[model samples]
Target: MTTPAWENVSDAFMRNDKPYGGGAFRIRDSEVMTLKVTGPDTPFKPASEWKNPEIAEHTEPWMNNSGERLSRSTASFIRGTLDSGMTRYFQQQAQDGAWWYSKDWAAQYISTGWMDFTRQEPVNGLAPQITRLWRSIDGGRTWTQLKWPEDRNISYLKFLDPQRGYAIGWGPNVWRTADGGQTWQAIALPPMATDYRKPRKQFDAVDLGPDGLLRVAYYVGMLGEVRLSSVVYRLPWDKAQFEPDVVLPDQVVVRLGSTEEPPGHTYSIYALSRLGPQQTDGDQNDNGKRTGAISMWPGHRNPAVRQLQTFDERYSLTDMDVGKRGVLLVYAGDSSRRGAPHQITLYSQDYGKSWKDIDDGMTQGGWFDSLTNTQYALYAYTLRKRQF
Candidate 1:
């Protein structure tokens, strides 16, 4: 049967739990498209109910940080005006131990989105640090600090699994940990040119390919003439070292050139997509433009490893989630024209080949927390989705 006919039949059987008799099924043809039917006991939970109840009461107090109770006039204004759904979600997070608040900063986690960690206060008379790092295994209820070396600057953090992970900081170095954050070891880095007296750059982002290879991007040097470097390296999870395996095509350099003028400097390389050998071809005409074939090197110490074709776009990628089919790239942008209201954009369903934007309906102002599947009670204005 044609798709429409099949859909009609499917819908008819689903709604009545049987087909209409005498074949006179005259329900609007489009109505037949509704296949799933929800009943009274079909498990409907209000957005408020999904929140942890314990946290709900503290929502306003947490936001204002004032013990004073609001007058009826003020309370009515807030309730009738602001959309409190996001607030309730955040409150739940705090109650569940996923909500993190220091004297200087506060953050909550949304499942599978950008993990938004902001600096709440200044320590030792420094600026309020709004750095995003660390991952939570039990949702946002608790977070494990993923610090780098003696210095507290954490350039980036990537966890392929709960156990295997990699991070880099303000030096030409990468750190690896096999047992979560319990122990860490430094990875061997390739040599830079003698004139490369640029300050050792930090890895801005790291991603693991489906094949288990790791790719990293970072920036080096001072203002005006900063060098945004992209390096594709292979490290066996079994061993604690990284052997320079492949370098992404130089076209990346050209792309960066277009973004940053003469003395090119990159703001950030936030995300990476891994493509198969066939899709890596750079010469293929894309959107009516000739593109260069990206080069990929395989094997270690081969002296003469062949270059393969694969193309991937790196952005100020805020967060990345890899699925079975493709990778999701989330970056900071202003999708809405509400004056400086930034948002997280999703480059959805591209197998490192091409990206399409998706609208997941997130709000501005608040930062993203860790993504997980854990559920909790709703009590306050903020609710936190926990990771188990």
Candidate 2:
């Protein structure tokens, strides 16, 4: 636990050209951002088009729960004409760079709740999947979608009210939609169980708590014996089934808490981790250009291995937020080469159990969204940022 030298407080933050990732949320005053650019003829798109063509010609707004604001412009123009053939299959994979688009996506209205977003079209074909949800109705804005079927493939999303929310992903899949996401369930793991045919269990990380409870971490075995574990889950709103009663063995790279509840202990969960990296020595190729390091499996209990010489060593945690005292936003690196420089690490105070990273000044990868409370970012080169 002695790793602090993020290049000197990372220059005190500050790199807000607006665009961030693929997430952002905060309604009431107005805020909704999303990104994933490079379409219209491709070539990595982005010759400036951060939206506001008079709010894209006054349309794309949908809020209810009371925060008011309607005219989804016909459901955002029929989801933008069914996403124009998925934007020409992501502009031919961003014309060879593979993918890039997400400067942050947006949608908010908050009076009780209202957040919505959708995109999922690369299933067996792989890549491409985004889903965000939030809906509370003290009665207004008519929203409802949070139910959690593993949240489908939620890259990143956040919520602090209505019922509490949080989300993250790389693989082991972490979720906690509550009633806001309509339904998402899974939490309470850790007892040493990594062998899903190996492959770093695909990759996983997630955190959420304002009380509803949820914390997850993953990495099992097979690449120099990788091993990382963490779990904690207990989402009760009257319980209809949202398991993860408590599976803490320790491997939680980060976690933040609070979903309200206090009276008799209805919800509360927190966990964090960071100690996995060390197996470096070149040529381990995953192709997209190396950059994959997160190993950890040597005597367990706070083992070591992190940021090994950094260099496209693919790493990932996620933007888990509890905000204002619990900010945990971690987006590891490695984007197959070509330009690198997309590292997002912002851990503020406790929500991450204990961290201080900050430095969110880079772009390229994409993913991360928060609703109700407000914060959105999406990228792959489409660039979008919203805080206002």
Candidate 3:
């Protein structure tokens, strides 16, 4: 807890020789001392002590998440533009410049596929060339860097076995390696409907499940009144084998993930669907949960997807990630039940089959999220992995 500021008591000094005893003097313990000296602005502005990005410096500052022009460079998709707020974690980012900060400055960029290969939280980043590649032989306890294929803007990659691996990105294309990480062969996908003007694809990413099912997520931008949704595609690793299947008939696919059922778990691949534009938070209702409903496809090649969850338009799907037997989701709102600004982290313990919030303790026990950030004291429940 922050100690309050010291109070001046000329009378206490005059009352007795003991400033803190007979005079009844003590520290005020005011939190004002720790509070930021912020200027009165609707959208919070940098303090006088901070370097105002509006005023250029010798160094070309990064485009702050906030509308300001200076400060550290950040992705375009975060919520609040500063020390604490960021875009949803785990959601696939298709655009090159799109990125998010879950709990730090480490921005995770996306490739062209349905998700990041290392959906692991707090991983360094998916930024191209950050490391050639990260491989974990001991079931992820420790990882070793290997030479990633030099030129592909790979968004998703997973090894089916010791020697065979597949990656998709750089467009609606993919790369495959038969001899582990030594080399990659470019595989071009058949031409997609990119010839139109309305609802052109802005972001694209791919996802592959443990069942060898391939899925692609597309955020098609609305160019005219002719809005389109059925953007997700069931791709063919070998086009000669099968044809691509359009998953959602009318809604846009914003998030895609797959988690194998662990023992008694009913988990499988899932997708979050949005009925409207999927670009920014503005697309969501006032409550933060996006307008789209979350749908799930149960195990063993379940072609039928059932509605898993939906909000009353008050909330939107801000961020998400899949787990071994659970799923992690984050939702933000213009205001909370008490009508204060808030964000909620949702988790599904039994994979995408179910969701509920338990005392994750990270946000439950209110803590300073940053040097100037304080987490919300709300969210009676939040979904998160009980174990790592």
Candidate 4:
């Protein structure tokens, strides 16, 4: 059987699920769209209850940012989600094999198309994709291609406001755009020292801090290599040269967040010690295919290991976000089990010391992969349930 046009979606992530105002954002057939939700009604029905939602026609074909072919790109169309009600953006693939942001509800939006990474080829007999930056102030209803300076691939992109933002690629340097990416300037990064081997930095997280600093995290290991530890660097708000490094123990830091309350500041970090495919033959949940131990570090303190059953092969941590409300955790369960794809959102009001399952009477269906929240509202992106 063929998947219908309405169902041929890569993701249907809920932007919000509140009673009065909530909806979802979806990427289907290379088009970015939304499901308008309006209600003060609590405890809505399953995701299946809603169908044939409206879609925005502004979109492009799915492709990797690399100088690949016009075919399907290995990159996920929508990588990250951020919505502050005023500023909404989606991190996705750029033209020349890098990730860029598409401000969904912004007055000025930007996107890039396919281009040759190397100048050896005449960019489909034209200019390279690196030289062009597409922009649209009218929320992507239209676009205008512009020019750029750097040709580097952005591994991490974070926007503190509509204008102030930071981006970093494979290199150790960081870039800033205070005028909504209209112009970019390179910033110096602290030198990373490797014990013996050359550092292969894999950008993991980049976030804006309360003290007007940019907190960046990366592991010094190549892809698929065993990572010993990770490093967190703090970039000052001003263009001053100060590198504050926080090196972790012998574990790969999968997630990093920080919260500034009153007396002092605390950094919430999630590190994984072990991970592998669980053996599943008879019982899917009983296997250890995705077995791994996740530990948390709440700034300058000993790590707290959450010795829970769900953290075993049956459940895998998918996403983590921290805000004024607290830290939110989204976990994906083994889809083999019945009713296992329901929303699994956990909250840790007291940092990562303890967490509470807060998915009571919420939207149901599929694994919640990415989650972001405002001071009062929380939004999540989920993959639809798999059919047998």
Q: What is the alpha-carbon lDDT of model 3 when measured against the actual structure?
A: 0.40
Model 1's alpha-carbon lDDT is 0.32
User: How close is every model to the real structure, measured as TM-score?
Assistant: 0.37, 0.24, 0.47, 0.50
Model 2 poorest 10 in a row by lDDT? 70-79
Strongest candidate by TM-score: 4
Prediction-by-prediction clash tally: 46, 84, 20, 11
Residue lDDT tens for model 4, 1-388: 2211112232333444332222234332233333222211223334454443443221222222233332222111122333322122332233323323333545433333334443455534445333234444655445555456545545556666556776665445577888877788877665442222323344556655545567666555432232445556667667655474465434344566555444356545454333432232577465344554445445443334342223545555555555444444444444345663554445554445555553322343322212223212222343332110
- True-vs-predicted CA distance for residue 151, candidate 3, Å: 5.0
- Stronger candidate by lDDT (1 vs 2): 2
Judged by TM-score relative to the true structure, which candidate is superior, 1 or 3? Answer: 3
Higher TM-score: candidate 3 or 4?
4
By TM-score, is 2 or 3 better?
A: 3
Compared with the true structure, all predictions reach lDDT values of: 0.32, 0.33, 0.40, 0.44
lDDT score, candidate 2, position 167:
53
In what order do the candidates fall by lDDT, top score first?
A: 4, 3, 2, 1
lDDT for model 2 comes to 0.33
Candidate 1 Cα outliers beyond 4 Å, as residue runs? 1-152, 157-164, 179-182, 193-200, 210-212, 219-229, 249-321, 326-362, 365-388
Candidate 1 structure, TM-score to reference: 0.37
> Model 2 — TM-score against the truth?
0.24
Candidate 3 positional error at 337, Å: 7.8
